[model samples]
Structures are given as structure tokens and as C-alpha cells.
Target: MKLHPVLVLDRTYTPVSIFSHKKAFILDLLNKCEVLQYYKSIKLSSPTMDYPAPLVIRIPVLLRHWQSPTPTRRAVFIRDNFTCAYCGKIVKDNNATIDHVLPKSRGGTWSWTNLVTCCNECNQKKGNRLPEEAGMPLLYKPKRPSSFQIALNRWRNKINREFLEALSLYGIIVDKKKLPEGSR
Candidate 1:
């Protein structure tokens, strides 16, 4: 059977990676990590006690090699807050597209700095041309997102209020309004 994976954060509460339910439990049992949240509907049962399945856990040590996520279409949408970079219009996932600020013909590679979330209309309007040539200015400059930012965006749906509160305590503000309605 496929088990739901648990999110793992580092000692500083920066999201690091995902672990299997069994691994999470083993870490918790070994006192190597602490459970921050538990799955609401699942539990681990033993002869002597029952424990809620871990949904999120934090390790006691810092991560040495956290990697940033690749700039995929979904990640780009998340980074741009699902808003058209050219027109600043909020868009649903189906209506959003990735636009290369500098057209491929002009030597722009498919990198984070070149990609931006764009609406269908804006995309078509800027097709195969530089933003300047298309008379469209980007609303914000694109940059590579940190691993923590990517993790937060990628796993927002799986995270609960307590995790969000912890993020707030660390001064990380997730703009709920900017996220897609379906994502919450």
C-alpha cells in the first residue's frame, strides 16, 4: 500500500525533504526528530499505546545540502503568485502560462530568471518577442526562489495552521490571497 509521506523540516524549521511514515516514526522513536503535526485520520497502534501518524516532523540537526526546486510550470506559477507578470492579473492554474521574458530566439534559456507566470492573453500578446518589443513590462523581476520558499509553496495544501503559525513566527509571510483558490 502507498502511505502518505511526511514533511521534514530542519532544526531551524526550514523545510528540507519528505520522509515515509515509517521513517518519520522511527526518527521520532529515536528522539532524532519531533512531530509537529499529525495526520487527523490515521494512527499507529501498538499493544501498549496509540499515536497519531506524523504529517510533519522537524529534525534536530541542520541540513547541509538543501536544493532549490527546478523552475517547472507549477513552481513558476507559485513563485509568481499565479498572477500575470505582464498585466498583474490573477489567474487560475488552467488559465496561467509561463512566459520567457527574453524570447528563445534572443538566447533566453528556460531558467528561473527568464520564466514568469503569465495569463493566456498576455502570453499570446508577448509571443516570440522580447517584452520590450511587445510593449509589455514585467510587473516584477523574476529570480530564483529559495528552497524553503519552494517547499512552502509546494506543500502548502498539506500543511496545517500550526505550521503556518510557525512560519509567521519566523517572519515568512505566505500570502493566502495570492495563492490559487484551489490550493489553500
Candidate 2:
């Protein structure tokens, strides 16, 4: 019951984080946040009255500073949806290897635009070679992902569909089809 997920939002209603229901309810109790939505109508009884469990809550100040994930192995794989850049094969992150789009030997750097995630087989096949040289081509050009994009992509699966729908009402569209097969 307490383990249910809760979406935390800023005063402006931008999503800030996901907290457990217990913490979210605590926030409501402390007057730190206002409940915006409830996961269920079923309420918990206290000495005073019924407390509706929160599924989403909003705070009272703008959260201008949003935390973004740094570019790392897991970040790259998640950003790429664990798909090979050249072959578009859906694979697990454990099986994915970071490949330099322009081979490091050819002066490629380890930045987002130059790095892509691929399966070990593809990495071996394309070893130190340009995609074209390896008779393969990238399915899409890589870019440095925004922190919001990175976090969203990371917790994509953990996000409830109802929460996503609620976000949609605020004009945030998360398209999973443009990404790999396994992602929502």
C-alpha cells in the first residue's frame, strides 16, 4: 500500500520526481504539497478523518533547477534504448557496447554525437571503422540528450500510463515509437 508510486510536481506543475505514497502523504500532512490526484478513492482512516492517498502532488514554488543525468554508459544505452545504432537490433543494456561513430583512431571524441550504443557483435563488426566502411549506416543521428530527456527515458517503464496521460494534458508528449522496440 505504501509502496505505490507518486508523481511530484512543482508549483508550475512541472514534474519534479517520483516518491513513494507514504512520503507523498507525509508531504500533504506537512502542508508542503497539495494533492492533485489520487490513485484510488479508497481512503485511510486517522483519528481526525479520511486521508486520500496521493498519486500526484504539487508544491508551492517553481523548481527552476532540474537535475539531468550525466552522459555515461548506462545513460548512453538508455538514451539509445539499448538498440544498435547501425543494425537497429533491440538488446539489453548489459549486451550493449558504446561505439564511436567516427572511430577514435580517426579523431572521434567520446561525446554524445560521436558515441552510439550497439550490441557486442556490431561493435566487433564495426571495430575502429566508420559505419559506411563497415557496410552499415546509423539508423539515426545521435545528439546530446537534455537532462529531462535522459531522466524521462531512464524511468520510462516505471512511469504509470495514467501518469503519462496526465502529463499529456499539460502538452508533454512522450513518443516511444520513435525509440526502440522494448520501450513504451
* Maximum-TM-score candidate: 2
CA-RMSD of model 1: 4.4
Number of backbone-clashing residue pairs for each candidate, in the order shown: 0, 0
Assess each prediction's global lDDT (C-alpha) against the native.
Answer: 0.79, 0.77
After superposition of all CA atoms, the RMSD between model 2 and the true structure is 3.9
Tens-digit lDDT track of model 2 for 1-184? 5255567778878777667678888989899999988866446668998887787789898766655446688889878977789889988857889999998889998888988999899999988889998998899899987665665666666566565666676576878565335434
Q: What's the C-alpha lDDT at position 77 in model 2?
A: 88
Q: Give the winner by lDDT.
A: 1
Span of 10 residues, lowest total lDDT, candidate 1: 158-167
Per residue, candidate 1 scores C-alpha lDDT tens digits across 48-102 of: 9988888779998888666667888888988776789999998998899888898
Clashing pairs in 1: none
Relative to the unseen true structure, what is the C-alpha lDDT of residue 30 in candidate 1, on a scale of 0 to 100? 93
